[model samples]
Target: MSKTMKISESLIEIAKPYAEAQHRSVPKQIEHWARLGKAAEENPELSIVFIQNSILALAEEKAGMATPYSFGE
Candidate 1:
């Protein structure tokens, strides 16, 4: 369950128009941006392309085309 918190008016103002343009709900658009921000912070050396490709790879795995990794001698 997610808790509702007060958001900054300026932030909501920024997100609302973009959310509408992207056909996403306001909260969902904020969530998407939050995910990107968190990922960038966690992986400073990674490019946006790399992060996007990783998301695609996870989707493929969930659809059953997984390539599990193993390191062995």
Candidate 2:
């Protein structure tokens, strides 16, 4: 279970509309933003497209679509 916490009304208001539009709950929407914010902070040089591609690559790997790397070819 996740810990419960309080957030400002302003933040809730900002999340609510987007959450509804995205079909996510307010908390889920906030968590998604937090994850992206952390990823952006960690990889300052990476573009959003790069980040998304990286995520897709990871998903494909988990689904057994990735091949082993060849160091020399």
Candidate 3:
């Protein structure tokens, strides 16, 4: 069985620029980080940047606040 969840439209909007900057689609970006998260659980060398950034992005969206970070800017 596969579990599912909903993502905020605001979060999607906020991540758009970053995803575009990385030349990745939003789904691909999320998958990339999901893999990173899994790998981080098994490896110590992976940076925590994605974890922190994703959390902050989600929190900002939930609170109806603007994102403070942007890639390639």
Error of 1 at 61 (Å): 4.9
Report how far residue 36 has shifted in candidate 1, in Å: 0.6
Instruction: Candidate 1: list runs displaced more than 4 Å.
Output: 60-73
Question: Which lDDT value does model 1 have at 1?
Answer: 100
Cα-based lDDT for every prediction: 0.87, 0.88, 0.76
Estimated TM-score for each candidate: 0.69, 0.68, 0.46
TM-score computed on alpha carbons, candidate 2? 0.68
Residue lDDT tens for model 2, 1-73: 8897999999999999999998999998998788777878899999877776787688899999999999988
Candidate 2 or 1, higher TM-score: 1
Q: Distance from true position, residue 4, model 2, in Å? A: 1.4
lDDT tens digits by residue: candidate 1, 1-73: 9898998989999999999998999998898788878888899999987886787688899999997788892
Residue pairs in collision within model 1: none
Query: In model 3, which runs have C-alpha deviations exceeding 4 angstroms?
Result: 1-5, 45-73
Mind sharing the TM-score for model 1? 0.69
Candidate 3 lDDT over 32-61, as tens digits, reads 667667767876665688566766677789
Residue-level lDDT for 24 in candidate 2: 96
